[model samples]
Target: MEFKPDWEQAVRRFEAWYAFEETDRPVMIVSAPKAPRQDPPAPGDLLRRWTDAEYLIARHEAAFRSTHYAGESYPHCWPNLGPGIAGAYAGCEPVFDETTMWLKPLDRPLSGIHPVWDEDNHWWQVTLELTHAAAEAGEGRWVTGITDLGGVTDILAGMRHSDRLCIEMLEEPEEILRVRDGLLEIWKRAYSALADITQPVNGGTTGWLGAFSVHRTYPLQCDFCCMIGPEMFERFVLPELRELCRWLDRSVYHLDGPGAVKHLDALLGIRELNAIQWVQGAGQAPTIEWADLLKRILDAGKSVFAYASPQEVRPLLERLGARGVALAVGASTPEEADYLVRMSAEWSRP
Candidate 1:
């Protein structure tokens, strides 16, 4: 299946969101199925299938064939070797399972383990190759996304193990900070390399979220923040995050769950941070229940990207207004998708 997206309108909606200006409505991206799609690989071949560039490309094509991308939605494939791939690039061994991959934390002391970016790293080479292959396959069809290079603390957790890293924060704070600072340069370098490889093919930059930016943009996150106190967060995590925000042209903080929400004020204060994508994890109140929190983010003058059901659309629009909100809605049918878009436009009108 081929995709001819409304490139102009998509661009306009996104630009308005970034500028905090009013458009026809908040950007609504709907992915409704047109046909039954192939299921993902079963447990045994999951890692193997993900590593195969041809299989990855073909899988994405087949998935897109079964869906209709409407409103601000566009077809994009974010090539990833899981979130811990950044740690793997820094010499940590990645242990892959049926569903996900994680780095094997160092057993020795922090001083004994050295983290350095190896251009020749096996995972790095595979990631680059997969990126190139996806771009080639997506030519004239879809946009390819930047791989998920997680934040400083999150990557460190993979290398040092989350539990030990927590102890390091208390026992050897300065040393931990030093290691994080050192990794900053490597992170920037890796991002630059991938950006260079993907820009020509994507015509711009985007990430797994499917939002487009004329300049480079990706979801920046620190899942480890949940384990640390606010003081430790400021001392260890915030500075690195600030520096990254300043380095990137555009960025969205992936605020994962309630534990991370405690740092919301600090995150919102960063001038260079463009948006916040809230993931209210399982068993938490649905997306609609967080209207007050979402409102605070908006009132702080930052954009929000969230997933919402059709029933929650009008309420969200009423509560947050439409200036800088983007919703990723999964509609059961194309007709429902069209209805939601129309309703959002109506609610947005002055």
Candidate 2:
């Protein structure tokens, strides 16, 4: 069964959510099927596959073909370079496994190491090529998403390694701040380059997160903030985040786990950030359990993007109403996706 999406209506719901206005219903997205698994890569093959333009484009096309887009969901594929690719572009070596990639920490102390963007870097070139190829492949069928560029502190943790960076935050706070300022500029350059390549083909900007915007939009995150206290977060991370928000037309924070909940107040206080995507990590309560937290975000005047089962949808709508909630729901078939979309409309406020 083919998943057909209502493009015009989806855009309307998204624009309403961004403006903190009520829609006829919350934005309801149906999840696509998992791409069929491929055999394990031989030594060196994974890197080769990632860099090969034809291979990357074909893989994306196959996945887009396999699923149905329903309700607020739309088709989008980002080159999967993992979250630390931004750090890799800035002079760190990346280690690749079967499913994802990681950055090798710098061997020297934070004070001695200087990170700069290398245009000729192998990973950087691969990222640029892959993005262009995906854009070409997605010409009429799907949207090409921006790769995971990661946040300022998150990229630094990849280069400096999280544990060492934590210690240095105490020992060399000034040095850390100086490095962060430089990295923010590199991050902006990299994001702008990808956006330039992607915007025309995508028909608008959208990222790994499925929210769509005619203007620029991408998910901003700092998983490392989960490990730090709020004082350190305010001092080191907030300023860079503010600058990033100011640069984008629309932005959403990816709040990863319970550990990062402490910083929500600070995040809500940022006038430029339009929304929050709260991810309650594994082994914890599901999204339904966090209605209070979700309510607080809404109360603070920011929209929310969350995951919920078909069974949980009515309760969430009843509790949170339909003003500013965007929900992603999973279904096994196109018929199921259609059913849920109808149900969502019924549950929504008139």
Evaluated at residue 323, the lDDT of candidate 2 is: 82
Q: Per-candidate TM vs. native?
A: 0.95, 0.94
Global lDDT of model 1: 0.83
How do the residues 49-166 of candidate 1 rate in per-residue lDDT, one tens digit apiece?
6688877787888788888887888777778777757777887788876657788887777776566778898988998999999888887788888787778789899888898899
lDDT (C-alpha, whole model) for all candidates: 0.83, 0.83
In model 2, state the lDDT of residue 227: 86
Worst 10 residues of 2 by lDDT: 34-43
Model 1 pairs whose backbones collide:
none
